[model samples]
Structure formats: structure tokens, C-alpha cells
Target: MRLFFPLLLSILIFSCTTKQKDHFEADIIIYGGTSAGITAAVQAKKMGKSVIVVSPDRHLGGLSSGGLGFTDTGNKAVIGGLAREFYHRLYLHYEQDSAWKWQKREEYGNKGQGTPAIDGENRTMWIFEPHAAERVFEDFVKENQLEIHRNEWLDREGGVVKENGEITSFRTLSGKIYRGKVFIDATYEGDLMAAAGVSYHVGREGNSMYDETWNGVQVGVYQHRHYFRDSISAYKIPGDPSSGLLPEISPNPPGKNGDGDKLLQAYNFRMALSRNPDNRVPFAKPANYDPARYELLARVYAAGWNQTFEKYDPIPNLKTDTNNHGPFSTDYIGKNYDYPEASYERRTEIINEHEDYQKGLMYFLSNDPQVPEDVRKEMANYGLAKDEFTDNDNWPHQIYVREARRMIGAYVMTEHDVLGAKAVPQPVGMGSYSLDSHNTQRFVTPGGFVQNEGDIGVHPKQPYSISYGTLVPKKEECSNLLVPVCVSSSHTAFGSIRMEPVFMILGQSAAAAASLAIDEGIAVQDLDYEKLRKVLLEEKQVLEN
Candidate 1:
């Protein structure tokens, strides 16, 4: 009896020490449940590798499935592989008559007539509802038999374990450890990359840093129609400086043109709203609603900036993927400067504040007496989609983190690459979107008029190749890590590469590279470029033409 008891005690101790529930091992460990993370896991599994997806959020597909149903697809010819497959699946879903729940299929097609969902030659539906996109991403995971651990955030401070400048494993806030031969930082924030001690950059760089035309603080360059057409006062009382600045306007001078600053472009939720009364949930007044917060927008309304409904791009089932539009619209200018490096708690606060600001803006427009009668009555028809984001009160679970920590990897892609001035040495994929950046700050002009700074939208001459070196870290920093979402690129270059389709393309390429490196028993930096390129081509990845 004593011998049996001792054996049982030893077994229990061994079980506790070796087979811990918190420890998970795989061939590749991907952080972030973004579009990139899902594609990466699918690719890794396709290559006969075991992969685990550790997502920071409960829902998958980051911005793609969040609320960005209206895709920012520039020159859709360049999109290939898993990214294209994703859109094709959406097309298949829309083909089913049962897919249209709130509205008739004929009604949606008629409204979305010119949009690619019906007009594209490839038969891929680029426009979709938020829930439809989420379902496709979920299907990818399920079809691949990939392991996903959602709502598991990384412990950025002291959770990473490294060996000789190589990431061995990382722990989450839940004390769960993910050990793998290679790791991919697919999060928009690059939490895993920073935690693993990889070098990265935030904010805009000076024009001289890469001899680019648009990189730094562009105070006067208004490329799109997002700027005010007429003069608007910054003060509460027109032409009275003593009246103080209206809400969301800075009192400081806009920075010099082409000079570097730590300013980040504004961010807001990409709302999936509906006008159908049967399927619409009215925009609620936020718990912290303040009428004064939208005074700038009220002035914008007074100036006849009537483009509020211009960006309510149509999707399936009579829904719209509404985005930021107009001079004083959804973009919360200058409020997210610290978001890339912010702690989880601080980021949550920032996100909540943005949500409240946008919510109140909607409510104010629909109900406030300051808003014009025509605009207010028109806005009253719109509301959040009743069937979308059911778990999160019909609000988008993911915020649009347009740009974040960009890794300064083996190659730093600059405007020279994006503008087709420089040649790609080792092309892994291609991105064709325009170099676009939203306003970074809103300040009073020297003439006492309100203005926005740092919004650039220069179209690239042609589709540009994404370099392989942009995915891997420096050999001395981390040998077995890949950063697909936040690749090595300048602020101006990233403006083009930050699209959801591009992220999915990069994710697939990064996973393929990682899988090859594991098979070759070498660091990701040491993998042969030709071999990786061959595999990517076989998989129908669109590189340089």
C-alpha cells in the first residue's frame, strides 16, 4: 500500500511538471486572429505543418470581417492565391438565394449594380456583409483543421522566451505558453514582434529619410475631398479667438511640410449599418454622449458638406459598409498617437473613446437641433445591422487599426519601391493600391481657419512587388519570426500595403517561407529566395509581371 501510494505521488508530480495545460507546441505559432493570421495558418497546414493560431480577439478576420465589407481593392488583378479564394467564396455565398435575409437578391444586385460584387469579370464578390466575411474565415480554419485560441492576448512585457536571438516561445495573458519552431506576428499592433525584441518603427518618417515626395507632415496637401471646401472657424464663435477652439481642434501650429513627426493617422470603426427598418438597430446614444463633441461636424453641415451618405457603400442584403468621409467625419483625428505601443488596457480605453465619439456623432446628427434638418432626417434612416456582431451589441468587435508598428526588417521598402522607382530584388507578392494616408491632425490655420494635416493619396504608377526581405527580421534580431501584416516599409509605402487583401497575400507568402525554412532547418533569413519564389508561383501568387 505504501509503495503504490509513492508511485501515485510521483506520477502526479510528473504530470504537473511536464504535461501542463498551459503549454502548447506546434510547428508554427501565429499570433493575432486577423486575416493574415487565418491565411497563414491555412498555408502552414497545407504544407503539412502543425500550426496554432493565438488570437487576441474573439472574432477572426480583423478588419476584413470586422466591418470593412466594402473592400479597398485597387487594381484587383494583382490579388491572388488564398486572398482571391476568400473573395470567390464570398461570391459563392451570395449566389445562394438564402444568403439574402433582410432584402431580396434582386434588390441587392440592383443597388450594387456597378460594384464588383456583380460587375467583376472574375466572378469574385468583393463586397460582403461583416458576418458573411466572418463565416468564410471561420470556414477556412475549419477546413484546414487548424487550432485557434481566441481572446488570448500576448503578455508583451515578459512573456517571450528567446535563445540566441531566436524566439523559442511566448506566453499569453492567460499564462498559456505557445512554443514553436517559427512564429508569425500577424496582429495589426505587432505585439508579438515587439515582445520578441524585433526592431520596428511607428509614425511617419521625413521625406529626406527615403527621398519620398509624401512621407512626413503634409500640412497643405489635400489629395482627396476629405478637406473642408469653405472656410470654417476653429473657435466656438466665428472670428472670435477668445471663444476658444471647438472640440477636436488643436491649438498648436501644423508642422512644417516634409518634416518628420510621431503623428499617426486617425482611426474609426468601419460601421456596417442598414437603412431597412426590419433589420436595422438605431444608433444608440452613448453612455458618455456629449452634444458639444460634434460641434465641428455641425459646422461642416452648415458649410454644406453633404457627403455623409457618399461612403455608405452597398453590400449584400441591403447593408452598407460605411467608412470615414467628409471634412469632419468618422476619422477621430490625432486621438490615437499612442495606440501602436499602448498597453492592452490603454488601447481598450482609446478604442472605447473612439466608439463613443462616433456613436455620439451619429446620434447627434440624427437628433441634435444643431444639425441641418435635411441631413438629420436622412441620417435617421440608418442604424447598425441587426444581425451583425450579435455578440457585441451589433457593434464591430474590431476597430480599424489602419496602420501600426512596422518592422524594420532586412529591407525597408520606401516610396522608391512603391512608386516603381526601385526594383524588387526578391519579389514574394505584389500590392497595387494607392499610397493613401488619412489626416493625422486637425489644427487652426495661420489664417484662423480650421484645417487637416497629413492626408496623402498619390496613386502608384503600377503594381509593385513586395520584397521577401520585408517579411523576415535581421539575422541578429530574431531568426525564426515572420511579420506579414506589419512588413518592413516606410509610412508612405505602408499606405499602399496595409489593405486587407494585401495582408492576406503577405500572410500566405510568409507562411510558405516559414514552412520551407522549417524543412530546410535554417533561419527564415537563411532560406533560399529562389526556392521560396518557386513555391509561391506554384501556388499562383501574383508577383511582379
Candidate 2:
């Protein structure tokens, strides 16, 4: 009892010491370190605002650094400002011979759709490597001498201290108060905006809400060019019912399209892998890796689905940025529905599940007997690349929060914007990608077979303008906050606008709005677009055609 008392006292003292050490402050506090957050902070600094990026992530670049190295740039012509500059810097980095340390320059080539690199001779854009992208963000901060508070979470309830419609400052969870003239909620989740009394929505809006086809729960849409290799067969692996459904197959009914509710998109680590023995850290079995979890993958193999090893596109240094492959590959569907607005404790559970599932999936594919011999061999050839993200055992720290709490701002972008009906007058940027929503729910069909839905892929007829009003809250609501990551748009429209390039574009535009608000000493909602457009144009931000 005496020894226990002393230990408890020591723990209490250590807790006090730890609590004392975690306080910090900044002038302009940006609440995320995503590609968007980085661009926002860089733009703020460029505008001569005393800025400090308070990132929830330990790593600087969000998806760009996390595993989405394969840049999801839709229209390269539309990408400009610091967003374009980022890819340009990546092009410059790869131009050097030293950049090709592991593989020949010609051998290690880009496969995703994009324009060629610009050499100041021609107008070109859209090319990148993950590490190069992160380095460019780091360089921007270092060059500008900006301050960043990493791993700081915003106070969930009373973080934003707003007075008479203007945010005076915000406090962090650790009691660090950041008093600033203006605050930009650049986070993917929009925590700052939510705390600042700004309105937002989670999950998909009902189709009736927007009079749109793709806004709500799409239960029966199968639009992507994936799935079974041969014919869509009934659930019968040569006489096997007691064997049960595959490991990843969900047994829930895909809710009717247009119904609308929260559903999980598939999440996987965009593995940065290397063939070079030194650089590659083999995808070892995770601590809780269970072969049974990958039982469905084996079922997929038996059903003649063998297109798993197709996503490991090689980057420089013999490294590959591994992405989600085939129908039942990396996407752990039905497992992350509660992750978006979950508490830290709940989020930890979701993250752990994703890690365990992904790691188990890899282990099963590489070693399980049920897996095809060729498939296992091909998967075995790759492992978690060493030398990349050494801190987390090469695992990506950021879970791909595909869609989250979206702000329903003044002018909500809808199918009208993508279909070119209602032209957005206050164009801050443009998006041309197809309205692509990944599979939302998987199910067991009436025919006693597994199926999935909510994977809509309709290419827009033309590039659509994303309105500035979409980024700002309504004039009546909180007027100072700007939501760049999750802007006001219907789920269908958001599908096209939710690319990384678009996020960076919006980030720059949001920062410009914040700066304009400060310059004019007016609410962000009341800032004149004439002046905003002029500044955005000067900054090489493609506000319009």
C-alpha cells in the first residue's frame, strides 16, 4: 500500500509536468496541415499576415504526404497559384539526376493522366511524387519563415472565441490560446468552423434537398469499371454455402438511392513502396493480423478475381505509391461509417480497425493458401517501403477521411453547377473531374450473392466553376469563417470538387478572402468579389476563364 501511494504520487506529478509543457500561441491560426492548410498558411504569410498553421497531423502534407502521392488533378489548366507551383517544384525536383537514385529517369515514369512538366518554355502543369510534394510544402514554410504548431487539436466545444460575429481568437485543447484578427478553418473536418457557430452537414443530403440525382443514398448504382473478371456468377464456389461470404463482403442492404445518410468510403494506406532492398520495408504482418479477416479475398481469388497487384505504380528510387486496387482490394467498406465526427477515442478505434484490416489483408494475400499462387507471389514482391515515414513503421498517419461534415454555406453547389445550368458568378476556382463517389455500402443480394453500391462515376460535360459563396458561411450565420476543405456543395457535385488540387485551389482562395476581409475590415460574406477576383487573378489563382 505504501509503495502504491508513492507510485500514484509520481504519476500525478508527471501528469502535471506534461500538462505544463503543452501550451502555445500564434497570430493567424490555420487549423489543419493538409495540402489546403499548407497553401492557406503560405498564402497568408505571402500576404504578410503573422500566421501559424495549427495542424492536427504530425506530418505537414495531409493526403499529399499521407499516401495519396498519385495526384488526383482533374483539369491541369485550372490548377494555378501555390497549387500549381507545388507540382512545378515537384517537376523541378525530379528534373535533377540525383532525384533518380533507385531507378533510371526513363524507367520510373508517371502513369496517371496529366500535362507534361513546364520548363518556362511552355504552359504545362499536373505532375508529382508524394515525397516531392511534401518537401515543397516544407520549403514554402522554411523559405517564408512561418511558424507551425503540429499535433494541436482545437477545443471541440468552446474553441472559437467570437465577439459580435467576429472571431477574436481560438484556444487549443492544451490551453494554448491563439488571438488573431482573422481565423481560417482549413481543416478537412471544419472543426474550427463548427466551433465558431458556422453551420455544416454530415453524410449525404437527400436527393429532394437539392433536386439532384446523385446527392442521396445510391443503393443500386454500379458505374465504375471494376468487379469480377469473368461473368457475375451466383454465390457458389463449386458447392460451398457453409463456407460463408468472403472476408471483406458486407451483408447489409445498400440503402435506396436518394435516401441519404452517412456511409463509409473505402480507406487504405497509399503505400510508398520500393524494390530497392535498402529502401523497401516489407509489409510485415501487423501485431493483430489475422488470416481469417482476409478470408473474403481468398473467396475473390477463387471466383477468378486476380487484378490486385495493378496499383503499385513505380515512383523514383524504385518506389511505388500503392493505391486501392480491384473491387475488394484496399477499401475496408462498412467499417468506418462512424469515423468522420467520432470522438478521439472512437476515432482511435476506427484507425486501429483500418490498420488491422489493411495489414491483415496484406498478410493474407501474401501468405494464405487460399490466395492464388501468382497473386501471392506478386503481392509478396512488395512490402511497406522502408525509409518512408519511419516513425509509423511506414504506415500513413492520416486516415483518408473521404467525405465528412460539409458546410451548407450561402450558395450550395449542386448538379446544376456540374451540368452547366446555374453558372457560379463568384467563381473562386474550377473542377472538371467526373462526379465520382466511391462505393458507399456493400450488401448480400436476394439471390444469395454479395454486391456493393454507391459508386457513381459520371464525367462532367465540361469544367464547372466553384463559387466563392460556397466557401463562406451565409451572411446571417458566422460571417468570418471560411471552409475550404468541405465547402457547400451537394454530395454529387462534391464528388467532382473533392480532389486534392481543388482543395489547394480553394485553400488559396479562402486565405485571399480572409486577407481581403482584414484589409477592408468587413465580414468575409460581405467582401467584394471584384476586389477578391482581382487579387486571385494576380496570384495566378484561376477564378474564371
Which is the leading candidate under lDDT? 1
Candidate 1 residue-wise lDDT, 1-545, digit = tens: 98999999999999888658889999999999999999999999989999999998899999999999888878788889999999999988988889988888777753442344654478788888999999999999889898999989999989999998889999988889999999999999998899888899999999998898899989778898888778999899988999999999988787889988888999999999988899899988888898997888888887777777888888887788888888988899999999999988999999998999989888988899988888788887889999999999999999999888999999999988988998988999999888999999999987789999888899888899999999988989999999999999999999999999999999999999999999999999999999998999998899996
Stretches > 4 Å off in candidate 1: 1-11, 14-19, 109-115
Give all TM-scores, in the order shown: 0.97, 0.91
**How well does candidate 2 score on lDDT at residue 353?**
88
> What Cα-based lDDT does every candidate model obtain?
0.90, 0.76
Candidate 1 lDDT for residue 74 = 82
Off-target runs (Cα >4 Å) in candidate 2 are: 1-27, 114-127, 228-247
Instruction: Go through the candidates in order and give the clash count of each.
Output: 0, 8
Best by TM-score: 1
Q: lDDT per residue, candidate 2, 203-286, as tens digits?
A: 778899888987777655667744434333234352355656655666566677688887746566676767787676666777
